[model samples]
Structures are given as C-alpha cells and as structure tokens.
Target: MKLKELIFIATGLLVLTSCIRKEAPNQEADILRCILPAEILADKSIDYSLPFDTELKAYPIYIEVKGETNLSNLAPQFELSTGATIQPASGSYQDFTSPVYYTVTSESGTEHRPYAIIIRYKQTEQIPTDYHFEHVELYDNYYIFYEETDNDGRFTWASGNPGYALTGKASSPYDFPTTISPDGYIGHCAKLTTLLTGSLGEKVGKPIAAGNLFMGKFELLNALGDALSATKFGVPFYHRPTQLTGYFKYQSGPQFYEDGKYTSNKKDTFSIYALFYEKTNEMPFMDGHLPANHFESPNMVALAQLDKAQTIETEVWTYFEIPFDYTRYNLPVDTDKQQNGEYYLSIVFASSKDGDEFRGAPGSTLMIDEVKLIYE
Candidate 1:
C-alpha cells in the first residue's frame, strides 16, 4: 500500500473511535409504576396500586381491608425504566408484612438503585386538636413532624421537603424548606421557609419551593412533571370543625420572585387555611390546584381561611382565629356520610401564598405554633 493511503486509513479509524466514546450509556434504574393484583386484596373493588416516589425511591402501598389481611407470598407487578431489571423479579411472591427491599440494575449494567416497598393498612382515624408543634423526627437527614394520637396512633404531617430533596440543594434537615425551629411560642415549632431550588428546579419549571405543612400525602410521582397535582390534600374526618385558631410569626424575603425572575412590585405573603369537603368517587381528594370559584365548589362544605390582611409580614407572634363559613354551601351536611368517614378535612400552612404557581420569594419564613381546631 502507498504511504499516503495507509495514513488516511489510520485517520478514519481514529474518528470512528471518538464517535463511539461520545455516545454515553444510560444509567437510569427506576420504578415507573407498581400494581398489586386484585386477588391479594381483601376488597376487590379497591385499587391497590402504589404511587412511586422518584426522589426517595420508595413505594408506599396502602390497602383497605375489613380485618387482618395477608401480605405474605403475594406477587406485585412493577414497571421499570427501559431495559432495567429488578431483583426478586416482578410478579414474584415475597413477604410484604415488613418492608421489602428491591435492587434494580440499569440496562448498561453500570449503575444500580435500591427501592423500598412498604405495605400499610389503611384506616380512618380522627385527628387531634391543639397542636403545640412539638413532636419531630429525622429521616434521611430531613425533619419530619408527627403527632401522637390519644389512642397511641402516630399521624405524620406531610410537607414539601421530599419534593425539595429532588433539587439536591439541601445539605441537612435545617436546610430543607420545611423544618423545625427552636424559637417557638412555647417549645419547638414548625418552621416553613421559601427557598430557591437551584438549577435543577429551574430546568423543571419549578424555580422555588415554599415551605408547607398539610394533613394529607405528598404524591411525588408527578412532582417533576406536574407539581400542582402532586399535592394530595385532606384526610378523613368524622367531626365538624367550626373554627381554626393558630399562632404564627412571619417575615417576607427581601425580593419577591415570580417565574424565576425578581418582581419588584410584588410583595410576598403567607397562607393559612382549612378546607372541609365531601369525599366522593368523582373527587376523592383536593390538590394544590384549587377550584376557580374557591369556596363555591359543590364539594366544599366549608372553608376557614386567614384573610389576606392578616397574612402580612409580622415579626411578633400573632394569634389569629377564622370561622368556617358553611352558609355558602347549598347542601346540608350529611350526618350519615360524616359518620361513615366520607368527609375530608385539611388544614394547610405555607410560607408563600402563591407558592403552588412556582412564584415566591426565597428566605420568606413562617413559624406556626399552638394550632387548634374548634369542633361543633
């Protein structure tokens, strides 16, 4: 072969190698969805599918049973990322009375992810009044507030901390949007602060995270894709609430930000409200996307919301009381449904009033303590 021809062949081979190196391998090993077969469920009519938390890599399945239900030797199906495989195999029977751990291997076999499958029995329990903002625990380096019921039952408060964890900005429990503060009206209180979610949050169109505490669960499955729908609000309540009273201290951040930009004219505000609504098959629960008519929704039995004027920035601890207005509701309260645990009530608090729209000022803080719900 000619010397020039040999050199040309070598150059072509070098270009081909460079192209191969540029193509990176996929490293995603995640569970997209989980479904439990109807045969394993005590109530065949109930859906036993679990919501997947991408950030936490866990599936918390709640099953409704009349009495004790068998959780052992039950196969659960899982839908995983493309080309990913789960150990113990999908649809393979395994004990689930206790949490079961599963490991997933990526298609490229270069990465692995561990997931926890937690099985919980669903039960309706009435919430206690007069929260002193006391009980809290640390989970995966983040603060989780919970309440101890009179019956020795534990009720955990849901917050935006788990969703904020997806940003990978928080370093400690205190760094999270929702956390505990030592400076309470009496003891430790629940502190909510709006914080910037950094580049990752901006990329997903959620530039800021507002500190919030609510009665229901935070569905992180669609958090990155649809944040508004991720917040499943309300829990079953048997009693009727008349008023909501609470003590709070608030301080708005220096600059208000909206849609990832600073808005000079806008001032930050806080939100404190409680909703009493009917739980029907059509509308099982409320979410961050509140109805346009607000209290006019047919499902809304009553609402106790702090007035906008009362949400102004205040350095001193302020006590506020709001009465639930049931007059706006056209239908009479169904005593049968209330006793059957068909009614739902949710009390929500947030650092920024418009946080659900991804508009808020970072550093805005709201500390809540001594919350009580007056019953009828």
Candidate 2:
C-alpha cells in the first residue's frame, strides 16, 4: 500500500497547485507625488512660497510663485508608482518656462504615461461678476464653458464631464452631464443633467454623475479613486460679494436613486451656492469632502446658498436672490489679507444636491442663466 498511495497523493497535490491562479504584475506608471525644493524659489524681496502638496495631483502640475522667479533651470523631485521609472530623470535641471513633459514607464513595460509640468507666477485677478452663459467651446469631444475677464484673461468653469468621460458612456457633448442649452432667458444657458454612469461606474461604486459647474479645478488623477477630493474648490477673489442672483429652471427625474439604488421616499433636488473663505498656508482650499464639517468650515467667512424651499421644480425661468450670511464667523474680514489675495470665492451649481455622494436621479436637470454677484 505504500508506493501506490504516495503517488496518488502527489498527483492530487500537483493538480491543486496548478489550479492556483498567479496574480498579474503591476502595470501602473503614474507620478504619485511631486515637489519643488525651496532653494529653487528662494527670494528675500518677494513673498514666495512653495506649492501645496495637494496641487501636485493635477494633470499638468502647476507650480505657482508669488513674484517673478527664474524657471529656466530647476530640479524637481517625484514619487512614482511602485517599480515605475521616469525619464529626464527626477531631480534633474530642466527649463520649465513652457510645459516640460516626462514619460513614466511601468515595471512590466506595458504602460507609458506622460506628465506635464508648468511654472506660473501667482497674480490676483478679479473674475467678472456677471455670468450670461453665452460662451462655450469643445475640448476633445465635450463642451467647456468659459467667460472672458475684463483684462482679456479667460476663466474656464470646471465640471464632472472629464470624470464621466472615463466611463465611456458619453458619445457626444449632450451625453455628458454638463452641456450648453439653446433655451435660455436670453441667448443661451448652461444646462446640467444628472446622467447614468453605466457599467464601469457601477463597478467603481459611482453609478451616476450629477451635472455640476463650479469655480475650481478637477483633479483627474483622483477622479476614480477619490472623487470627493478630486474637486478642488475656490479661486482667489479681491472683492467682497454681498449677494448672488440667478435665474434657473429645474425638473427632477422620475425615479430617485440613493447610494446606487432606487428610493421612493426621496425626490431629487438642485444645489446652487457660493462660498467665501480665508486662505492660509494651512487651509488653501476646500473640496467635495468638506473635511471640517459637512457644510460648515472654520475657514469659511460667508456663504450664500439657495434655500430648499426656493428650489422648487419649475419649467419656467424662475428668479431668485440670496444674501451672504457672514454671521457664521464673527470675525470681520481682514482687509490686509483680502488685498494680499489671501481670500477665495467659489460658486457651485449642481443638478443633484447629493451628487458628490453618488446619490441622484438620472434625468434630473437644472438650467442656469444670468448669474450675477453683487459686491458690497
């Protein structure tokens, strides 16, 4: 019984080993972190500061300096994905007046990703208060809304279209959550529609995308992994805004979905609000996560938000005005900090109020037009 039984056991063990699947090698080639040394931006005369750690996550990494700083020759440090390498090797001097492209290759050599580095001088420019929603342009295949400043600088509005593009469900500009609408109180308007994200989004636990427009930048790198933090809110503002006035038309979707499931008790609602906050080295800006509180933050000085009672479902163009409630923070606005561009203002519009949490109705729509900010 010994030899035959031993051979049978060995055969069974071999079969079991063969059935165990081998995991695939890591193929990600991404720049996880980037930093510029203080020596490169040292200036005693001008108020110069190093870039924030969070700003490195942008697609085209932007390094902002307070005053004129030499960017022709500089070195940068980068932390890449495990077993990945970047060419023009990290910590090497390169001209950054224009964008410098670096290519990263994966451990398996199956993936190659390109990253752009841009150096910009920090300048405070007050955005125009009036927003007529008349200008738009196409990028890649989707529409982008932008406004022209008095100084001829263009201010582009950010949306979740880029994140939705990852799902491969959008075939045209209209397929996106944000787009332009011909129907407006005047010539045209910004139309936001909550849309289904389909298979890929379902797999990632984000089944729907709410139509959103905001004064901020969308960090695409963090879109899929951490959507809440991907939306970097607020831009530098020099004026004191007292009120926000706008006209909108809203229609809720037939079915409400919460946490990716159908819910009969809830109805979809729209969101329109403005945030004014003091920017410091500690707290540069806010995000969808709202780390301090769900909607309140210690840094926030004032807020102008549309009340839920005022956001009724109406096909007609309805006018509404909200005043900035500065009572939240008893401290008065610091005139010195305001003049130094240490304050920021952000206006946000969304078809679904709880969209960032992946809860909304697919067909809910909110059309916004003629938005204006009244200054004190």
Candidates' C-alpha lDDT: 0.82, 0.83
Report lDDT (Cα) of residue 304, candidate 1: 91
lDDT by residue (tens digit), candidate 1, 194-251 = 9999999998889999999998878777678778777778888888899999899999
Question: On a 0 to 100 scale, what is the lDDT of residue 126 in model 1?
Answer: 72
Identify the candidate with maximal lDDT. 2
- Which segments of model 2 are wrong by more than 4 Å? 1-27, 39-59, 82-85, 106-110, 221-226, 291-294
Which residue runs does candidate 1 get wrong by more than 4 Å?
A: 1-58, 68-122, 291-296
Residue-level error in angstroms, candidate 1, position 109? 9.0
Superposed by TM-score, candidate 2 places the C-alpha of residue 21 at a distance from the truth, in angstroms, of 12
Candidate 1 Cα RMSD (Å): 5.1
